[model samples]
Target: MGLQTQLRRAIAVYRFVALGYPVLLGALAFDALQRPVAAAALVALLIGWTAAVSYRYTRNGYEPKVVYTDLAVTAAAVALSAWALAVSDRAWPISLGPWLAGIVLVWGAAWGRRSGAVAGGVIAVFGMVFRGGINENTVNEAALLVLTGFTMGHLVRLGVEAEERTRRATERDAAARERERLARDIHDSVLQVLALVQRRGNEIGGEAAELGRLAGRQEEALRALISSEAYRHPLDGRRDLRELIGRHAGESVTVAAPATPVRLPTATAQEVAAAVASAVDNVREHCPDGTRVWLLVEDDGEAVTVSVRDDGPGIAPGRLAAAAAEGRLGVAQSIEGRVRELGGTVQVVSGPGQGTEIEMRVPRPREGDADGDAHRGR
Candidate 1:
């Protein structure tokens, strides 16, 4: 248990013992006033014993041994009260109050609700037997005491469960936020560097060219992994797709979009942008110098689509799928894999002689879909 919980338990034990002090003093004074020397001595001894038990409880930090000590003290108090009742002529109903209160304190600490109820039941039975009859006042008081202990114990348990749930929720939220932040950093920095290497490979002839091509392919695979739903950033804020694409468009690259906004899910938008960027990189590497690339963004009612077409040598039959299998999978893995994850389809209408037309279609997410909520919340 936590230090705070231990301290609270200690405080509860001390409070119960302290509450007995006034009752003990009152019992002794009543016995003495009635000229019952033996009864007064018994009450005095009970007070001293309770005080010693309380002291030991404080010293031991309210350990399990305190429960044994409490039982012993309660037994002595009950026996003394029974003896006093036998000797006293004046019906001393109030004399049983201290012993009953001690039972409440002991059972409340030891076994909680069930034992407290049992203790209360025992006290009620004793009251009826000793007094020789049950009265309205006795029943009402007994019911109130038992209910009070039960309510207190139930509330304590509820508070503990609520606190634990809150702690777990806070931890999960923190972890998600951290993952989102890391995703943003990777997308902005490392992905950009890899794209640059891929584009510059054509300019640097020979072995350096081959190295550049290899780096470019690796970059595409990395982008594919990042665009997957598993790596999507949760904190992706509202972004203008046209503006993001325009920012990356160079002199040779041409970006075309509708005059109106093409709002897309955060994950979809990021993947589309990444795919467009990769397509442009391929044109820069394979096509003749200064080849023009066109990017078109179309927003249909039910879905959003992006088309990246190039006036360059198109992909050969089975080449895209074969490249993906051989780990040379840039377009297939990054662009196609990303669209598929979003419950969308990627169509590559390309062949030798005819220019390549890469179209990506992502359907709108439904109300309660996990991916939809994830992008919307971001």
Candidate 2:
């Protein structure tokens, strides 16, 4: 059950327990009492209110306004105790005695510490007003009421927060289990089929060799997607962009980065890395096998810029527009989409004879960010 429901039930139980004190005290002092019928009627009213509040609060919905009303009713009753009760040589105990605590708990459950404290103070004030002045007993009761309300209010807050955390953790655990089941199924069937197609297509030649390469790429990507315990990129914490870009180095690709770490938030770094991967993939798909590619990462104060350069026959004017028209979105979506999503920009520099260069710029993480990853290039 939620914290509010549990607290309401506890308050209900306390109301019943505390109700006995005033009823018993008043009954024992019946002979010396003033206005016996009114006292009996007030006790019955308290009973009816308790039962009604308990029934309503135990159900699904709750109205915060009810707490305020409850406090007002209890205060009015306490304030009238002086005129209603017998004024003999001995001082008669008030009707609500410890039952006042029920109001405090109700306030705590509905709101929090501040409301609880206010309820406690108001209850104490009404009680003192009924007695005409303050005394040792009144002081002690006031302290108890205030402290109990504050403590219970703080506990309710902590309990609700813990319950929310537990719920989120359970959801994440269930999602992970579902993903693992799907991964097992894909590994057993689709991965094997793709591997077979790649091998057999390579055994044949001509267009089959191209088909084999495509199948191999799909198999590699699918395997990585299922096995990695991360999102599209590792975004759990801080990461160095330089380390991620360096992974693209190969026989035909060279990476140039600053001597110092170009630190960025995990999400920003991963997005930047994903965009770079898309650019490298674009080069590999369109250019000749032996074409040289260079990747450079630079920190330009307010922003970080990474440029992917390829020494191949450059893109012709209007070539990208025609490709987009034909629904090919390698450069448009994969490269440009990823960069733009990060609140960054993408610039394509190319011509008919000159080589192509795609530069992506992202805002540098500011100082005092949680990751503490804002950095400059050496």
Candidate 3:
């Protein structure tokens, strides 16, 4: 059952003990007949306290002041019971112990160990002091009050912590399942179309041959991305950007980065890496097969900078604008769009013979920053 439910049941049990205490005390105190007025007043207070406790705490909500009130009333009642017994002619001690002890246990269960200890300590100390000296019964009652309050408080805290851990685990599991479902969808449709375009374009020959090769390269990149450990791992929104970027380095591609790790939120790092990969793919499709491409990663603890440069023939004037107008969006959607979503800037420099250099810069998000997704199509 839930922690609240358990506590309500415990409150009911304490209330039951409280209801019986006055009647039990009347029977035990043979001097009760001698001090009729004091006996009646004490009994009346105990009965009223029991009803108040039940009405305030048995259901859902209760104010913090109610607990303090209960403590004050309990302390007063214990003191008065001792006074009533001392004035009576009877030599017997009345067992008014249960009323205070029950309240201490309830406080402990409600507020945890420290609150419990305070409430329990007050009752135990006051009870012993009013009785004159510390005896075996006094020591046992004090020990019982301390132990019950602290133990119940600990149990309540443990239950709360366990529930929190379960909630986080459930969220992680659900996120992982959602990612797998999306990967399947992308593989079944987008990846297949890219692959088919590559194969058919190659068979058609001429200008279509170059277009097909570009599509083929993109298809391979997408396949590797979807199957990568970085993609398959749970989306925690934090990861090492250095690891993701390093995956693109092989053969004609060279990666230069610091020895230390470059960490970033998972979505931001992935989008940056995807943008760099798209730039490299452009180099392979347009430049010679053996052309060298250099990728540099730098992080100065404020922002991340990535530069992709290739020693290949650069684009002529107005080529990018012309391509955008014709609805070709590889550079727009794949690179610029991704970085823009991350609240960053991108610069592209190329001339007829100066080769191509694309630089992307994104600031490191502030700690506990409440931003949304850094890029779409994750």
How do all models score by TM-score? 0.44, 0.72, 0.63
Residue-pair clashes, model 2:
0
In candidate 3, stretches whose alpha carbon ends up further than 4 angstroms from where it belongs are 1-5, 18-22, 28-63, 83-111, 131-133, 204-218, 235-245, 250-378
Q: Candidate 3 versus the native: TM-score?
A: 0.63
Please list the residue runs of candidate 1 whose C-alpha ends up more than 4 Å from where it truly belongs after superposition. 1-72, 84-89, 96-112, 123-138, 184-378
Model 1 scores what on Cα lDDT? 0.62
Over 295-349, each residue of candidate 3 has an lDDT whose tens digit, in order, gives 9999999899999998888888899888889998888889999999998888999
Reference-based lDDT, each prediction? 0.62, 0.79, 0.77
Give the candidate order by descending lDDT: 2, 3, 1
lDDT of 2 by residue, 1-378 (tens): 766677778889999899998888888888777778777887888899888877887884458777668888888878766666654546745546788898898776667777788889888887777775698878778898888788777787777767766765675577667778888989999999999989999999788888778788668767865765443235435678887777678788899999998888777887898888888878877876688999999997799999999998899999998999999988888889989988899999999768899999999877656333212110
Quote the lDDT for 230 in model 2. 45
For model 2, the superposed segments whose C-alpha errors exceed 4 Å read 60-62, 86-89, 231-378
Winner by lDDT between candidate 2 and candidate 1: 2
Worst 10-residue lDDT window for candidate 3 reads: 369-378
